[model samples]
Target: MTVVHVLLGLGWWLVAPRGAQGVPRPFLSLHPSREVTLGDTVTLRCRVPHPNVPVSIYEEDGEPKWQWDRVEDTAEVSVNVVTRDFAGRYRCQYNMTALSRFLRVSNPVELVVLDPNFPPPVMSLSPGGRVKPGTDVTVSCWSTYGATFLLHKAGISAPIQRQSLSRGNTATFTLYGVTQSDVGTYGCSYHPRGNPFVSSHPRSEVTLELEEGGPSMDHPVSQQPAPRPSLSLHPSEEVALGDNVTFRCHVPRKGVRVIVYKEGDGNYRWQQDGVQDTTEVSMQASTNEISGRYRCRYEILAPTWATDWSDPVEMVVLDASFPPPTLSLSPRGHVETGTNVTICCRSPHGATFVLYKAGTSDPIQRIVTGNTVAFTLHGVTQADTGTYGCSYRPQENPFISSPIGTSMTIPWHRDTFP
Candidate 1:
């Protein structure tokens, strides 16, 4: 016997169990679908395999929230006033006496409720400047209140990414190996932590654009110095052991041969002759020994002229075995402008320490060697007020580094003194 059902605008054909020849699997459907606004009506209907069976609908908790007995094969429970508590997982099950009193349960469905009054989260893009192909970018959603973040791309009905945070008010989504297809407008909506169904308003959109070809300079092509090639790391310059990393070298012209060099080693790490202006080399960082500084140069195939090497880029593989560094800020509470403040990082082992400011990609300052590094801020201003973190690499283990430490915030005042 064949049983066909349609729910939520989609159709499905139900199949019977092998031993129970004519008993089709029980199914559940929702009226008004999974997501609904507050005060909306929703109905949960369960279609059982047998007629005149007892059906019960339950939430995530074991206790049944609703139950009904019907002579037909279907049982339904309706909610006239949908509240935040109604937003959760719901499933239905039925007991059939003909089948040895066995109970069969339907698949669970998620219910989301939107709150029209909640304000939207603010969305921002990382590498806020220019984005080029073969690079990774992060999109952040931040709100004053803690919530679950839903990242949405324009023209897509459902969210592309979802992140729930129990403590923080911010969520970040990273787009790896970005290409031309990644260029689009994105926004974010959030559901407050305790009330998962209460979605906030959508944030303003952020448009992403990729650099098409070679970079442009204001100076004339004839008067300027020979254009140098540029090198970039995809995903990130920093990575974990066993993670795959890609190195991209972009030249001013296509059909050129590119060579990437490793610092301190006379031998070139990789070389490629390609028709496209941008070429990429991918490898897995199996060991911390792979961490090092690198540069790339390009040679015009026809003219046989080699361009100067691009700026050095370092890859740091994080070693979780090392303890995370610690960050501290002086002038305990709030400091007035024009005041000198000290920020310090303490590590278990002496090495290279770096300081990072929140919301920015690159490190603000780095010390070549130290167990405890103190960074002094001269005449601190409003611009210096933000959260800061630190991390360090052991001198003996140059290739591996500790994870980022806890962050400390420094607030600055205009002029509190007379």
Candidate 2:
């Protein structure tokens, strides 16, 4: 009798077949594809060269999940309602009783069961008006989760067209020279690629209506397009890691919906706010992911027209949480009235330094230069006798600022010099 044992490698237990090196392993394949929507049926086929062979399918290192006593050259295993438990790597092995007791193992294939609760793709028809028979028709499908898209007709069991690639969660299907028979409802669904693929559920559908005769010359009058909105960041574009920044989108028109977009967000709108022409959205710079290109556009709900996207603006987040700059006074601590005192702030990196007096909203002086900047206070008086601190913003990123450095107290007194 031959025995099969398990071996551990790379933190995973692998079972190797004890079949002879010259023997060929069984071939494993999926019926529809590697990805299946939840509650959908999927079939796994195991084929061997000879008939009446014993085949068994195993997942990972567990025991056989399916077994076939004496199938033809091919054995089929079906999953009626695919569930979360059916999502994993599967492999098949077949035993040859007459040849040897050892089993021949086949290569593993991954099965991904998509989630049923995820939102489906949106379908839209081009040439919003009636479509003519001899003219080409285009159907577009867009979704937040985009990978592989399938265009399905109402009465078709299989997809009419399949798109292997998509442009940022959007795919377009064209029907050439449509006829009267082409008048039907069409819908689309997509499968997003990941560890476990995601399927678009509750798909959206669109209908195609053909014009009776010659194309109608009575086209709707064109209206002016909406004006583009301007986008600006409060407190500048560059911000500190933990700070918050507000994105302001403004346009000339009023009572319009404003939409914001982040570069890689695909078909999903990043954010929307304000019924008026102007809108403000605040976001925290908690992670590096927040740093990206952003733009905005305004739409008129009554007319149902949107303006072109505005110019893109980049936001940069700086990690400025380090040791504070050093503050030093030229005259040490105490200073006499009618005398000159120089206060210098030094930081590790080249930055702009600002000197602030205690209990004051405004800074005494702000200087933009190298790593160090000095403030000269001539004819110092009683008013200068207060605690002062200095903060610096890196020259490369002016919007980001470091915490206030150590403070120093200056004592004021009457001039007693010769």
Candidate 3:
């Protein structure tokens, strides 16, 4: 009985203390649910109920991994500014003879690190200022302050080019063999030693413009120096009847004078001679007096040189004859319901005729004939009464007709009489 009692006491003490309260299950907790970017830190704690048992703490998938002992009920693990590789699942466990419970994985905390010191680099191409396919081009990446630089391209999973410019903050990425498939958006990143790395916002966007077979400008003039003497004209293209237009000439280079002339008008109408430097000439638009092509000529008068006429540019004066087109009302200018009225279009000389009604933008109808044309208004009504006009297209270079026609208003109440 004494021996049995001693054995029973020892067994009870060992079993009861160990099974009831050897050490509470290990627990892991995090101070912050999320970590700040770049220059921030994260703290992870492992809690053990009893101070007698040993505790080991280390980080996995971060910098280095190790095991530690002697924590005194709690163990703290700290890491600074997590990186892309540091982003993953982490766990802490208490080990005495074997691994203890995992403590619920510490809620899977995530550490976010941002870089505020380094700014994104700027990228640019040279030569034509446009990215062309199958052409050798250079891409330059320049940053304000960064540690490492990387350049990525297509077909390659990793960075195709890299440079370690420890001297300055600028790096250049050269593509030795360029092709059509090489066109794409490129990104760059900068990482310092202790701080987190920052990626630029896709600064380089490459577009491929293929060269088509054509007579391209072989020696195209990117820019031209100011001419010795310059001439300018108002109403460069289109002009209206009775509208006055002006022409001016200026000498950008010294010792040059300008002469103005009106071509194909029998003889030169006006001439300004020996006019040192810059001079101008003007012409009036007349009904029958002025009409044809006009141009200017520059002469090195003081330097004893022959006069050279600049390119010939043409202008036309518009006139559709006087008294306009006479619009005569048929059937005594009044027609009964369901009756037809003849609207004849007449002018002196018009290859094409356009007729319109007052207050309406679109032409009522058009007629193309030698000199005169006509439109028959079937079932004439009160809506047909309004002002009317006719214009003619000339056969000459101007190709625009004169704006002269007739205006007539038919009474709406007259239709009720007949």
Candidate 4:
């Protein structure tokens, strides 16, 4: 007798323990289908497809999470108490010596554990302005529940710094005299001071900007003359709608009031005064107001002379008014395992699109091309079955994600006989 069974996310059949009499093919299974909350018991059963074979298990991209003793028929691995770390993908395999074939490995199984008490912390960049080289920048991570904070820069493996928030749940990491090298994405996470073992999810990311010289009229940094402040956009020339877009105008010489403006043919736009030091000005962009160009300049007090306006920065928008992209699966309605499926999204006006599966925040694939975006999924199995949607943002303004407009369903692929 040969054993055949379904495993997590494995859409098709696996090669069984070949030529073995009465041997069951092993597959990794979890007791809790949805989530294993705190204190919940989760059981992982490795049905020794082969009569008596030793088995091993790994979690998340081949990290050994758990393993079991050699069992003749079946091996049961149970987590009496579940933690946040246990919430991840898992797979297992076993060996059958008689057939000279290695253990048939199972597909990956994802485990989710919800912890409501320790929510992720929030990270903010302070004095958020046009940071010049040799200027100081401060990054702060704050949490209501956790006492320990971890700061991460884009490339560094370990946390750049792990600090205890001695001040009322707020930990501040300051980078003094920043340079072009410090220009990259940054984020923060927190773990309970006492638990030490459990860590909350990381907060969103932020970036520090730097340019060689100040912005100039109709240019990024100023080019006119010396002693003038330059202005630029926090991100690139493009900006998304409903996103926190910031414009900064700064001078190497400190102690000045900055004003940002949009220049046009005999018309313009600008900011308020009475602000001192390096200050960040945030504006909520509206659809009607987001079109056209922006520029900024600084005013030195006492002398009362204003610097030349930095070059105009174009602020693009992923116009919400543009029709949203459409999602469609190949073969129309239902699909089966081992069938190569094509997921296509089209937009007449969009320059780029992102495909997102249900329950996941990050897009599976991002297409930066013409109107049509296609993601081909090979032999889609159970794991790929879910509601999927796609949205397109103007390539220059990717930060503004279009509101999700359409979703398609991938039914569980069932084995069928023709």
Q: Rate the local accuracy (lDDT) of all candidates.
A: 0.64, 0.63, 0.46, 0.57
Total clashes for model 1: 1
Model 1: CA > 4 A from native: 1-24, 71-73, 128-131, 155-158, 202-204, 209-418
Top lDDT: which candidate number? 1
User: Comparing candidate 2 with candidate 4, which one achieves the higher lDDT?
Assistant: 2
The best candidate by TM-score is 1
Residue-level lDDT of model 1, residues 314-361, one tens digit each, is 788887778886666676665665466676677767466666655558
Alpha carbon lDDT of residue 189, candidate 3? 56
Report the lDDT tens digits of candidate 3 across residue range 327-392.
Answer: 555654334543565555565655445555545544444544566666555444333333566565
For every model shown, what is its TM-score relative to the native structure? 0.43, 0.36, 0.27, 0.32
Residues forming the 10-long window of minimal summed lDDT in candidate 3: 1-10
Considering lDDT, where higher is better, how would the candidates rank from best to worst?
1, 2, 4, 3
lDDT of 4 by residue, 26-110 (tens): 6777786534556778887766655566677765333345655567766767785555766555667665555443335565565
Q: How accurate is candidate 1 locally (lDDT)?
A: 0.64
lDDT of 2: 0.63
Q: What is the Å distance of residue 53 in model 3 from its true position?
A: 78
- The clash numbers for all candidates, in the given order, read 1, 0, 4, 19
Query: Cα RMSDs of all predictions?
Result: 23.3, 27.4, 39.2, 20.6
